[model samples]
Target: MTIATHIPLPQPLASLRRRAPGTVAGVDWALLSDSEARRLREFGLDEGVEVELLHAGRFGSGPVAARIGRMTVTFRRHIARAIHVQPV
Candidate 1:
């Protein structure tokens, strides 16, 4: 018989997928992932990140574009949902 030590198991459910390349029409500043959150923090994509819908992809699934920090980023619907943003 072998003795076992109690160790907290990592929660797989909460783990999010890495960001992929895509475009969003007007991703609200209310959706981003943990890594994305960290990446955005420096770019003003944080809680105070400004948001504006530059244009929409004809189908509305857009390639939404927004201005965060000093850079402009575009993302699609699926990828956008993965990125959690918040209002300033």
Candidate 2:
């Protein structure tokens, strides 16, 4: 008998801190509220977007500073965790 296992997906954007920038693989829409997801999409944070981790907030694991497209956006750690990314 063969056991089936699932391959893990890419890590979340939040985990990219201190690492090189990555491309936005996808977002956990279910993890975000409708309005929140919508807002993020409006900000051009949807799938296939290229994101670079600029820096973290003063406090540890606080807001994440990232560059998405041509704009820079800061996201809470939780929100950053909701974004799946593939490191470049």
Candidate 3:
């Protein structure tokens, strides 16, 4: 017989500043408005997608940028907070 183990590796994107890159786990839709959610979906921010933090706002008080696939997307800090990512 063979045994296998599963471990948890999910985290909020907002909490991953300056850390390792990760895959998009999920998004807290409840925390975002309809338009905001729609915009993010349009930008390809979905589960199983790869995302990396590129740059943060000045003193961490403005918008943030991240690399998603071949495109780079920028949004408010709050939006990043709503995104769940699993470190890669």
Candidate 4:
């Protein structure tokens, strides 16, 4: 049997700012609330889905702009923090 190594841990979506644009990642639903999770799902931010950080709102790290699937969505910094993501 071959050995498996180097599994990356999930990171908060809020941390995506440091990453470059077009960086695709998957969401972690375990960190979100029922309603918040549902809302995100409606916006197509479900787990395993690919998301790219388009841009961050100007002034004080406000909202984060990202492209989920074919649609673009924005979320507050706090909310984004609650959502964990792993690079895809």
Candidate 5:
């Protein structure tokens, strides 16, 4: 789907700053895993889903929050670096 609102959040989260996760919670994040990347197209993390930034650490340290569908996945900042989301 599309992010219903516009938030001045950081990067990818700008569209998902204040949304809720749905069902595909464990889908990690596109910015995190390469091993899982190729398989992403087959999952719900596809284009129609909304991803939000729940929480982030200092300078990309610790774990960050990405709302993918119904789950808010806490991912490592390094993981997020690998993901690339275009403005929609």
Candidate 6:
């Protein structure tokens, strides 16, 4: 018999600054302010969406840019921390 074990690969986008791009797994809405959540939603950042981490500022603590769909969006590191992604 053969068995498979599924391991969770989702991680915060901010933590993936040095890693490869991934798909949007989920958002930690509870960690974000109402405005932040709304803004992210407006940017089309949701589960199942493909995302690519383009760049980050010093020490990966500054603004982060991610390419989603046909557009590229830049946001603060804290906001990126609230987004979870599954590496592709």
Top model by TM-score, which number? 6
Residue-level lDDT tens digits of model 4 in 1-88? 9998885666766666443432225455676678877898688665677666677666647998777778878887767776667754
- Quote the lDDT for 81 in model 6: 88
lDDT (10s digit) by residue, model 3, range 29-84: 99999999999989878999988888777765787788888888888999988999
Q: Mind giving the per-residue lDDT tens digits that candidate 5 earns over 1-88?
A: 8879763322443223334432222333545556656545444565446566677766546776776666656655665544444433
Worst 10 residues of 6 by lDDT: 12-21
TM-score of every model versus the real structure: 0.39, 0.79, 0.81, 0.65, 0.47, 0.84
TM value for model 2 = 0.79
Model 2, 1-88: lDDT tens per residue? Answer: 9999875457888777564778888899898888889889899887788898887766557898889888888888888889998877
> What TM-score quantifies how close candidate 6 is to the native fold?
0.84
Candidates in order: C-alpha RMSD to true structure: 13.4, 4.5, 2.9, 4.1, 7.8, 2.1
Write the candidate numbers in order of decreasing TM-score.
Answer: 6, 3, 2, 4, 5, 1
Estimate the lDDT of model 5.
0.50
Best by lDDT: 6
- Every candidate's lDDT: 0.42, 0.83, 0.83, 0.67, 0.50, 0.85
lDDT of 6 by residue, 5-30 (tens): 88658988877755376899999999
What's the C-alpha lDDT at position 10 in model 5? 28
Candidate 1 structure quality by residue, lDDT tens digits, 2-87: 99977432211112122222222233344656665555455544333344434435553556565443566765554445544432
- TM-score for candidate 3, residues paired by index: 0.81
